[model samples]
Target: MVDWAAYTLVFVAGLITALATGIGALPFFFVPDISEKFNVGLWGVASGIMMAASIFGLIPEGLNAGPWTTVAVGLVAGGLLVLVANDLLMDADIDSRTYEEADFKKLVLILGVLTVHSFPEGIAIGVSFAELNLGSGIPLLGFTVPALAIAMTIAISIHNIPEGVAISIPLRTMGVAEWKMVWWSIFSSLPQPLGAVIAFGFVQLAEPLLPAGFGFAAGAMIYLVLSEFIPDALEAGEELDGKGYRELVAGFAAGGGAMVLLLVVV
Candidate 1:
């Protein structure tokens, strides 16, 4: 029989990451405007955390679970999916940067496009929990919690805060309520739970494809950092003297350091 308890725990873990996005909008509740430097830093922080998570967390686990060839195939496939999705979004004239201003229909379209990116993050969370309750994990709340699962959950949650801020900026300018900003930010990541369940189910059933799962998530996130996150930071900081590259680097270093610290602890 399938362990519903384990499934529920995993789902909850994924949900936690989704909810953490709301924390980003909490600043808007108090402040009228966030500084551009801070915004750029947030993006840089996200980039750093994601890069570390993929290189140190996901890829290593994938290699341990399966061969490097399997991981490589998954990496290529993951990046390719993002590339195709980006083209589709461009052709559709759906600019994710300005999605907060979208109407209902456009919002739906944006969410659909966002799934391509968010799904991999969810998958990363799910794949990390592949060893849950497998008799070789830390005991927690009546379950054997995999250390990797905890680490990924924390990493993704932290990574998502900046995304929430990004989503909220346009909304804040449009005079959207702070509460709504939080809701919209969470909405952007709503697909995570579903993605988590699907990936977890696949890995649990097939067992052999776990490495591919890791690679796919890692590849997708790394591609997004390069293609979207960094550019967004640069664009936002364009008015500054050095295009905010220094802030980005500083944020990246901080984020990377944080994740590395977590890795060491776990």
Candidate 2:
């Protein structure tokens, strides 16, 4: 019963969300060096935005699709998927060191590892496009555009800034050119658009599963933040002699609080 055209439009919206991550990297081309402190702040802002999107956007949407049981199952499945991926891709030896000394093969390995974390973000963007039209009668590019789509796109784009900085850090240490750093950062996030499109298409085809889709994306993202983002922040902050840990905690709280405020106001 789903309209293919509408579905395709949603998929395209997802693709745009993913591609926006690439835009975050473009800044590195112009800046001589991005400070670590600045990167940390960026990450904090990204963390806040994503948490807000998940809480305000994804969870409520999921609950609308079905009973609590459905959302619960999707959440568990999403978290499990990430856990399996982490176990499979993450090796302490490889992750313990920075990417500077890594050879070409090692770089590929790092990319693979990073993909596990980034793919969920793309999925979140894709899932948010499910309500592309809601009740709107207006058409956009032959399909109705949902307010949720615009919000998700903006949220995902904002989230990518910190991720771009994270990608650039290793490249900077490797003495990669500024522009190249931007390229690589963007390259790492290419999967986002692809993931978004696929997610949007899937949700359209299986409309009844929309709630599960939302939960799945939310679960993956929330788990990633708790498992990956927080830990990484802590590790990066370790150089600050205890001050880093404080900053990490403070940043997390600030980011989460900001998202809460945004949800209230917008």
Q: What are the per-model C-alpha RMSD values against the true structure?
A: 4.8, 5.4
lDDT value, residue 122 of candidate 2: 62
How far does residue 132 in candidate 2 sit from its true spot (Å)? 9.7
* Model 2 TM-score, all chains together: 0.63
lDDT of 2 at 178: 76
User: Over all chains combined, what TM-score does candidate 1 have?
Assistant: 0.69
When summed lDDT is taken over every stretch of 10 residues in candidate 1, the lowest stretch is 101-110
lDDT of 2 by residue, 1-266 (tens): 86777656655655565555556567666667545554454455445555666777667867876787887887787777767766655443454343433333334443443454455556666676666667774466756667666776777666565556555544554556777766676677777767676677676555556667667767766776677666655655666756466666566667667666655654
Question: lDDT tens digits, residues 169-247, model 1?
Answer: 5455456689988998888887787777877888765356767867876787688778777887898899987999999
227 in model 1: Cα distance from truth in Å? Answer: 1.7
Count of clashing residue pairs in every prediction: 0, 1
TM-score of each predicted structure versus truth? 0.69, 0.63
